[model samples]
Target chain A: MRSVILSITAVLLALLIGAGILLLSGASPIAAYSALVHGAFGDAQAWQRTLEKSTPLVFSGLAVAFAFKAGLFNIGAQGQLLLGAIIAAAVGFGVEGLPAVVHAPLALLAGAAAGAVFAAIAGALKVYTGAHEVITTIMLNYIAINLTDYLANGPWKDTSPGNIVARTPRILDTAALPTWGPVPSGFVLSIVLAAIIYWLLWKTTFGFEIRTVGQNRHAARYAGIRVARTVILTMLISGLFAGLGGAVETQGVVGRYQPGFNVGLGFEGITIALLAKTHPFGVIPAALLVGAMKAGSSQMQFVADVPKEIIDVIQALILFFIAADFLLRRLLRLKAEAGEERLVLSTGWGSGE
Target chain B: MNPWRTLWHYNRGKVLAAAALVVFVVWAYTRDPQIVEAVLASSLRLSIPLILGALCGLIGERSGVINIGIEGQMLLAAFVAFLVNVYTGNLLLATLSGMLVGAVLGFFLAFMSVTLRIDQIIGGTVINMLAFGLTGYFYQVGLVTKGKFAPIPIPGLADIPILGAMFFRNPPLTYLTLLLIFVVQFWLFYTPWGLRTRAVGEHPRAADTVGIDVYKMRYLNVTLAGSLAGLAGAYLTLEAVGSFERAMTNGQGFVALAVMIFGRWNPILAWGAALLFGFATALQTQLQFMNAAQIPASLLWLKQIPHQFIGMLPYLLTIIVLAGVGGRTRPPAAVGQPYVKE
Candidate 1:
């Protein structure tokens, strides 16, 4: 319970600091925030878009958090997401005549599998050899970006007589994921998937092994767990989630894949996962908050002409405070309450294991 | 046998990388002889910037820093170098400004990550993001409003045999890249300061016990990396193009990082990897002349081959190589650990 208080306190402090920065930048903080709120959730339509945006963030954030739980920093979510989107789009476009029920899930499966394979490249290297994932994953992102760009530009290009942008042909209608009114069916699926991920992380034996591996590899090995296998598997699962996010983006919202349209969605998952303190369940609200901020940015620009850079400043400040969280704890004179396990996991870089 | 164990047992990544290299050479031959010559030459020429960029990675990481903001550092250098070049038209002045900006960025990163003990990754990310945003904004507001910079090739040097015909013929800025690689290599292996830098990287606490200022050395190396990375950007604008374009470094910073790893974190090895990446890139561009070839005909995937996979090759191969020869060496012990001095 006290952990909840800590998180909420962090959120409030971040908002306050963000507000202070906005005021200094000469924007009417109150009005700008009001516009931000209105833009994100003032209407039914806005709520739908916010939920839509949150769907991808949920999966991607969880993808990153899952890896953290298993003691790897899987920075290739962007690449995984790209491979997922590309393969899913390929299936969605290439396969015709399948029934709607079979088609949507099949495309989704293909996307997830592609992302898994792509992600496995990094995992396999890390496990079998001794490559640092942080480097490979970042490199893979460039490959994914360029590969996706090339495919969209060339062979798989929309080729619609009038089109020029690097993107895929629209997925067939039968392949599209259905929606419930303005709220997407995919969002509900994402929520359910989040619960499942939480279960797999906290309740299951495999989850126990994974967290054990993350906590300390040598200790887990002593307990008869295979450290390398767990690390690779965790990365594979992480890739699957990111892939699912991309699949949802295609079937639920965009309807087609366009290179460069989505720049920081996967990388932003890092921020969301971190802000959530690597909690699977906590990722929901954290992703939603970020989703709302992103969704509202354009409207914020429209209403206030306050450069969107202010949001980045707010985010950086929040991350700064979170990284130096001890400062806040000291400043607030908060006693260290027992049993609040705050974000304990190994980064590939620093942890002794 | 399990694939993982098998991979560990045999360690085929380097063997695979070598095979890939042989295959590429063969493919180059199968294309037009003239085109292959030009492509090889072009690839070697292209290797210059990437070598320098990789060197930047080498300096910082060897001494326990990961400079993800190499892109931003490059951008700042390119932008500032362009401005200085427009006013003075002197290549030396342009290069100095670039190195200066990069050093400042590097120092700033080291201060935050080493001194304040911020999450080095986050600190690096902020630097990258800040660099992108700052440069992007200024290029739009200031440079475009002001004017553009022009490229200046060195006199007669570009006309000499082989070296002059290929490298010197292009631009004076290009040679700076080659010089930096050798200089960094020398500094790392020869200098007493280099030995101390390595000492701090291997085990900062131990170095501290031995009376070396770990924080100070890290700061110095990281800042030096920033300046070199910045010079890479200056070369991009002043030598390659006349003006700074938005996000023009275009992931080269990350590529340099891959080169750093592929180079096994040695400056010379980094230069070798940079050259390979450059060659692959040049081949991709040069292969356009062979569009009508019998080979490129069968493998249209070959067209997307180098562009997509070449970009991805280092990353994919890094894992491959590591698996093949796991633990031949290791990153510095204190790499990425924020030093919050007690």
Candidate 2:
């Protein structure tokens, strides 16, 4: 209950800061916020946009949240998502003459597999070489950016008439994700995945092992949990989630593999995961909130002449409040948690020894 | 095992990195002897911001604060410096403003980590996000072109053969970067303050017990480090590139962290690593300009490589370097830990 109250307070404070910024910029906060809400949920198309935007955030958020259970910070979600997206697009376009069911699922699985493999590299490096995953994942993001750019611009360049951009050919109609009213099919899939992830995190033996490792690695080891395997497997699962996000993005939203279309969706995952407090179930509402902000940003800019980056600022502020919960505690005049005032994310460098 | 053999095993990654670089140099030299000097000069120029950024990380990390927010600091400083230069048209004031902004940010990071006990990485991430959003928003509304500082060549030194053109013919900011490398190296290893800073980073409790104010050292070091990143940002706007672009620092700040790891957390070694990264970046650009007809037909495959592939060189090299060498190097024992007062 305290956690929930804290979460609510952090969110309200972030919104307050956003409002303050809006006022300072000479834009009426109420007018701008009303426009934002209306833009995100006013109409059917607005709802669709919100859902579509929320779909990838859900997957990536779950990815990060799930890895956090294993005490791994998967900063490479962007790279992993990109790999998933491009590979899904590849499978979507490269294969021909399959029904929608077979082709779409195939493409999605391929994307998930690619993301898994990409993320597994960092995980394996951490396990085998004692190389910190943070640095490796960050470096890998750059490599992924360049690698995808090369693939798009070189071999996969769309050669259709009047096409000169760095993008892959459109996926076949059979591979497209169908929309059901305001909700995209991929969005529905992400919701299902979230539930499944919650179950995996709380109900199963593997989930127990992961949480154990996260809470106390030495205890996990004493309890006969294979720490390295658990860590690597957790990353693979996290990658799969991020990969599905990319696949859904390709099939549902973009229609083709374009470089810039999926630029910050992965990084936004960090925001979502943190906002959710690394809870699998909590990711849905958190993702929806952020998705609403993203969906409304352009409309806010158009209506209020306020820059869309304000949403980014708000998101950062949200993360800040969450990370520094003591700020909220002080503001609310609440006491700290019973035993410890802070939570551990990951152990410090070289402490694995 | 013999002691010498044990030491060799421990330093195995460094030896492997050296071998890789040697092989790369030999291969590049074999491909085109003339472009080597151009690449070297470009590498030196490109390394200035990287060296400064790495030094920022070095200082902060040495004080037991993980400042992944260096990128944010650089971006914010770059924006401030550009804004100041556009309005005031005073280069020194603009640069100082950038550094000042960076210091303020550093102070906030210190407050979060030292006072509030927030995770350093999370604090840094928040700072990066804020910097990106704020700079990006302002850039859209207020982005403009400003006059850039021109290279002030040192007369006799600039005339010297190859070294002069590469080392001396740079803007004042770049020279300061070069000079600070040695200064930081000497300070980190030789000075009393440096020793105390390292002690705080490695074992804060011990330092505190011995009457060293751990909080003060961390606060001062982090703020100073922020200024270093800020200066790097100022260089981007005032010297390297004259305008502020949204998130213009890109991932160079993160690469600087990799450079910090590559240098084994030593200032001089970090400088060398920064130069190596610069060389990798220059090599990418140089490789793109290689004449297809000049090279042997067998090596013509290089020309077929995509620009994006060439762009991957620096990042890929960074990954390899980290994977191979990161495990071998030791980080400060107390890094990323919030010092709680007893």
Candidate 3:
């Protein structure tokens, strides 16, 4: 509970500093914040957009959070998400004559599968070749971007009259995810899925294997867990969550996978995951907060005369505070737990070879 | 001989990777000779960022600190260089400015990761996030404007041969990169400073006992590496496109990491590995011509094939080579550990 208060205060402190910066920039902090609040919860329309935007953020956050649980930081969620969106789009457009329920699930499943495969490449390489997931994922990200770009530019291009944007055509209407009045149904799905992920991570046998592998591979191995398999599966599951986010973005919000539109969603997931301390359940509120900030940023900019970049600055500060943890440790006067080292990278990032 | 036995006896990863490469080469060759040349040309050009980026990683990681902020540093350097070069018609100034910016970033990272005992991965990730958003916003807003860096024509090198024209005729940064590779190679192997750096990387405790300040050494190496990465970013705008764009580097930083792995973390090996990447990029371009008649127009997936597989090539090859060679090729004893003084 103290930790929660601390986090909220940290976020508020950042907002105040940001508002001070706005004043220095000749903007009214009060006006900016009011506008931000109004814009985010301004009306049904504003709420819809915010929720629409957050639908993907929730899953991406979950993706990063899940990977963090296994002690593997997945910096490639962006690339994996792209793979998911593109492959899902491919399946959506290519497959013919399937019923609505089957078609929607199939496309969604395909996207998740693609993300898993893409993630598995990094995992498999890590297990087989000792390649770091961070590095491999980064490389794969470039490939994913270009591969998707080429596909959008070439065969999958919307070829509709006067459309110059590099993107795929909208999927069959039946394939799109449903929405509830002002709130996107994807947001609800994301909530449900988050619960499932939390259960899978904390309660299941597989979850135990993952946490064990993350904490200490040699010990996990001694305990008869297939360390390599766990590592790969953890990444796969993490990636599937990320891929679902991409699919949601495509079918629910944008109706097409535009390149720059999904730009920072995955990286933002990193920030969200960190702020949540990589808790699967913690990601929901974290996502909503971030989603609101992102959704309300332009409003903050317009009415408050504050630069939208201030939000990013605040986000960066939050990440710095969390990652450095000097402030948190000082404020709480929390004693270091002897065994809590298992929560982070315990055994030096190695094969223990 | 049973294929499975032979495959299993050795590293199946390498065997599979090698087999894939052979298949690709054969497919490339059977298509068209002219296409091959075009692909070669394309690959070489595309490899510019990767080769230089990998060199940055080699220098940083070789010193025992894992610098994941290479991408961020590169982005910052590229943006700053592009802006400065455009404002002033001086290429040298832009390059120097880029190195300076990179060095500052590197110093800060080293201070945090090395001196303060912060987790290197967290430190690197923060740098990446901060750099990405900072640079991206700067570009979006008019804080940094893009422009051209001076292109120089090499005196005799440009006239020497066909290869010289493509390699030497345009930007001075290219030659500087090539020369720096050798400079780095010589420095790593023959110089006393190089030996100490290697020692720190391999066994920092031993080096510390031998009178080297491990923290100081890492700080210097990381700072130098930041500048190198900055230069690579600068090259993207100044040397190649003559402008800076958002995320201009794409993922060359990762490609560099792969190259570092493939190069066995040796400077010379890094250089050779970089050229291999460059060559692979060039080969893909050449294949475009080959597929002109054979592959259907819409099925032009062949053209984008390299896009999907190119970055992986270095990594996949790294896996193959390392698997075949085994982890006999080791990183510094304390590559990722943050040093804290008691």
- Which has the greatest lDDT? 2
Chain A of candidate 1 gets a TM-score of 0.94
Docking class of 3: acceptable
Look at candidate 1 and tell me the lDDT of residue B315. Answer: 51
lDDT of 3 at A110: 90
Candidate 2 overall lDDT versus native: 0.85
| Candidate 2 lDDT tens digits, A38-94 | 889989899999998899999999998888888888889999999889999998898
Backbone clashes in model 1, listed as residue pairs: A129-B323, B11-B324, B12-B324, B102-B226, B102-B227, B103-B227, B158-B168, B158-B169, B263-B269
Task: Flag regions of model 3 displaced more than 4 Å.
Answer: A2-6, A9-34, A87-103, A159-164, A304-310, A331-333, A337-353, B1-48, B140-157, B166-170, B286-329
In terms of DockQ, which candidate is stronger, 1 or 3? 1
Candidate No. with top DockQ: 2
Write the residue-wise lDDT of candidate 2 on B1-342 in tens digits. 343354356657665876797677667666765576578779988898888989999899899988888889999999999999998889999999999999999999999999988878788889999999888776655556568888888989987655676788888898888889889877877788988999999999999999999999999999988999999999999988898877788788888888887787877778878988898788667757877766668867777777777777777777776675555677898898888879
- Give the candidate number with the greatest TM-score: 2
Deviation from native of the Cα of residue A131 in model 1, angstroms: 1.5
Write one digit per residue (lDDT tens) for candidate 1, span B1-342. Answer: 332344335435654775787677667556555565566557666676677777877788778877777876887788888778766777678889998999998998888777666667667666676665455434434453123333245588744434444555455556666677778877887788888888887788788888889888988888888888887888777766667777788777777776676666777666666777777677666654465554445656666554665656555554444443334555667677765555
CA lDDT scores, all candidates in order? 0.74, 0.85, 0.74
